[model samples]
Target: MAVAYDLEGQKRAYKRWAPYYDRVYHKLLADAHAKTARAAAKAGPDILEIGVGTGLVLPWYPEGTRVIGVDLSFHMLERARDKMLSGAAPQTRLVAAMDACRLGLADESFDAVAVPFVITLVPDPEGALDEAMRVLKPGGAIVISSKLGYDTGAMAKIEEWVAPLMKKVGWSSAFRIERIKAWAEARGDVELTEIAPLFPAGWFKLMRLVKRS
Candidate 1:
């Protein structure tokens, strides 16, 4: 369990999780990742994927779509790079270590951006969203898949009880999709959609937002 929200904490948690993350998380997130990737692939070729954990969605992207993947954890990025070199992720043009909130890329550098299961993990999700907006080209799209807390439900009560424990294990149980929606809407130059969860459990959501700049 991690005790902090700093980069070092992310590295610690991810380094420990890297070895078994695919087995535990891949199956659970497969449907969500696949659905988001399918929609994003149609956006354009040049794509930047933040928090590209283990490159799980790598194989799903279209062949011609070029992708640059960045993650805060080196151990995780190593896994992503391996997938690329092994031909399991031919669309992955590059996999490198970087912070999502401050990627030093040029403005309008990408045709699209993908942020899968990352908002809750990062310390500053709003800053990360702003960065995504900064790097994306006009008319570019952003796809995010996240599991957010329910406001009213027996499960919601359970989540509230276990959130602290989950955080120690490395994620918040209460990250909100509304924050992302509001941010985009506030810009007054974006299109946002709340897609139905691809998985039947309905714990996750796919947010598709397009910059109209």
Candidate 2:
């Protein structure tokens, strides 16, 4: 399996992908984006979206919502900034270039943290999740939409085989859901509130974790 995490590689990959990211993923991930937005909105008004590439989920957030987005790729944020400036997603107050594993944000600040199709792409997913949980307020939630790999099966084998190739493009194909589950269990500060499979035969998933007060 591909376990190496190259920050520079990710940056380079996304820089190349930013220009046409929406054209490639907008429709494919529309449902998941909408669902993620709704889940975050339901949690509360103060929302932070991690790896908010191209701001595809921005317009989906309800009117009057406070949305802040962050990504490691300046190129991707440029596109997202353009979308924000177009007034397509007026709810978005800010979009900045920030590292997922080292967010320059306050602790226990946001009511909800949304990570869409980003966990597996993160260089250090556990560290990123730690940051997400740190920024999340008690009683708030961390919502995620991602393509999770199988833990054991022929599909898992295939994912392992393809992981290295996928890494060059900016994400891991063998990132398992069990890793997230283990993170939640280890934290003991959050609980699994929801885990629903998304399109393309359950390859994608929408998961939520509520922080305990």
Candidate 3:
């Protein structure tokens, strides 16, 4: 089994990835980012994006959307700050260094929460989702884009085999969709509203969970 992921190691990995994040991920995740941002925007104007590295999706939100983004890595937040200053991401209102699992924001303050490509990277994915739910307004949505692991197939075995190696780099391909489903099922206040596959052969997917009104 792979060692449990820690926040420190994850921060360190993002620090190294900070400078090149947008360059490396911008085009590759463009569709996912755009779709996620648009979905969040549909919820309302106020959005909180957890693990908002480099603010790549900030620019994709509808104009007038007020987005407050947080990340654990200062280096990553710094680049995101630059995007705000450069006018590339006008929807961004603030970018702070904060842990996703323990958000320092007011409860029920946001209309939606967007977490793109971050669920598998966090040390506690369910904890992060809990925080997202804690801050989301009733009837609001939590939008997530992630690479989900297969349950029982050849692909499942492959993800399991490479999980340790992937964990070392910062994310786990062994993270399963059932885990998120279980979390939602455990919380009766939340509902799985939508799930759709992204590009690159459905390895990545977008999920939306809505809080009960």
**lDDT: which candidate is best?**
2
TM-score of each: 0.87, 0.88, 0.89
Error of 1 at 169 (Å): 8.7
What lDDT does each candidate get? Answer: 0.83, 0.89, 0.89
Rank by TM-score (best first): 3, 2, 1
How many residue pairs clash in each candidate at the backbone level?
A: 1, 0, 0
> Could you give candidate 2's per-residue lDDT for residues 1-213 as a string of tens digits?
555768789899999998899998899888889999999999899999999989999999998689999998899999999989999999999999899888999999999999999888677888899999999999999999997877889878877887787678555656777899999999898999888978755557889999999
User: If both were scored by TM-score, which would come out higher, candidate 1 or candidate 3?
Assistant: 3
Which residue ranges in model 1 land beyond 4 Å of their true spot?
1-5, 150-173
Off by over 4 Å in 2: 1-5, 152-173
Write down the lDDT that model 1 would get. Answer: 0.83
Candidates sorted by lDDT, best first: 2, 3, 1
Q: Relative to the unseen true structure, what is the C-alpha lDDT of residue 190 in candidate 3, on a scale of 0 to 100?
A: 97
Alpha-carbon lDDT of model 2: 0.89
Across 102-213, the per-residue lDDT of candidate 1 in tens digits comes to: 8988999998899988887788787888899899999899898887765667867877887888678555656765677678778887789556665736667788888886
Task: State which candidate has the highest TM-score.
Answer: 3
